[model samples]
Target chain A: AQSVTQLDSHVSVSEGTPVLLRCNYSSSYSPSLFWYVQHPNKGLQLLLKYTSAATLVKGINGFEAEFKKSETSFHLTKPSAHMSDAAEYFCVVSDRVLTGGGNKLTFGTGTQLKVEL
Target chain B: GAGVSQTPSNKVTEKGKYVELRCDPISGHTALYWYRQSLGQGPEFLIYFQGTGAADDSGLPNDRFFAVRPEGSVSTLKIQRTERGDSAVYLCASTPGGSRTQYTDTQYFGPGTRLTVL
Candidate 1:
């Protein structure tokens, strides 16, 4: 019974400004968390993932997220927002380890980031 | 080094009709997955295949949804009696190995096939 909840359905930010997309999760055991970005008409691209090794995970395009166990959160952040950064972002959790779901991914509803220039 | 690919980028059919969506995983990938994504929603898991066998199909919504990875490389997701509710983007993903390996944690996604049931 692992799930992810993205706090915001849509977020708008000015170019070069800081950006933040919040996500929370509920899992019974240690969980694997991931961030994926999807551009229009394109496939999902892996942004970053948090395993047991790292709490502050850095991803491509200068994006990063911090895995907070106590807060039950994994929030994605970026220092500067570029036009290319505007896309749909998903917070995902793995279900294989605990639920025997064979590496299935449970995704949040997703947050659409709009970068305003 | 092509990424995972899916056929018929878009499909339109009438309700009660059947449809088949295909996926071609990355060359060396041993695990394939199927997911359905509705508008403005995250993709929902449908099934997982490991080397030609479906290791997990519990996520399938109903018996009308079925999938098969015949040769461990290609997979076909068959939907029977399609309904308007089934209209959504069907995404396919693949990973290099099974859950036993660390690399398997990352699932590469395809562009997805948008299905519209009229």
Candidate 2:
């Protein structure tokens, strides 16, 4: 079993401020993690993924996440937040199978990000 | 021709009415998935199909929700006796099968079909 827990329900950040969204995971098997963004009235978009490769994964929109196995966390970070960054973000985990054969994604509840200008 | 497509855009129905949502995956893509997103919530997995067979359906909330891919291309999700709690935006995604490469694991999403049950 694999699951993800997003730490914040809502995060308010001023424009140009740093942004951080925390996520933790639980899995009996090797875990493949991902970050997805959903803008209002739009479909969910993939930001980044950690499939047990590089510890740090860079995603779209200047966002990145570091997978810390020891901490069981994959926390997203951005040097600066933009007004366009206002959206809901989700953390997802998948049971790692060889060659990404097992691709069932388990989603977190999601964190709403509000960036003030 | 470019991305996943879902029909009806929006649907409003009375309780106990039957509703169907359609999805047209990218051409030649062999994997398809369904998810439900309630207001302020992330997308929840409902079902997934590999080729013509459903690979996983454990996330389906109940038996009333069923999906089919007759020709392994266009699919339909049917909800029988819909209830108020069933209201949400239904999203469909498609990817390549077998490999977890960028084109396969990276799913292309549709705008979604918003369903409102009164």
- Top lDDT prediction, candidate number: 1
Local accuracy of candidate 1 as per-residue lDDT tens digits, B1-118: 7998999999999999999999999998888889999988899989888788888888899999999988899999999999999999999998877556433378899999999999
B2-91 per-residue lDDT for model 2 (tens digits): 888899899999999999999999999888889998887778778888878887777799999999998889999999999999999999
Question: How many pairs of residues collide in model 1?
Answer: 0
lDDT of 1 at B5: 92
Task: Kindly report the root-mean-square deviation of model 1 from the true structure over all alpha carbons.
Answer: 1.6
Clashing pairs in 2: none
lDDT of 1: 0.90
Candidate 1 per-residue lDDT over residues A44-66, each given as its tens digit: 99999988787999999999999
lDDT, candidates in the order shown? 0.90, 0.87
Give TM-scores for every candidate, taking all chains together and pairing residue i with residue i: 0.96, 0.93
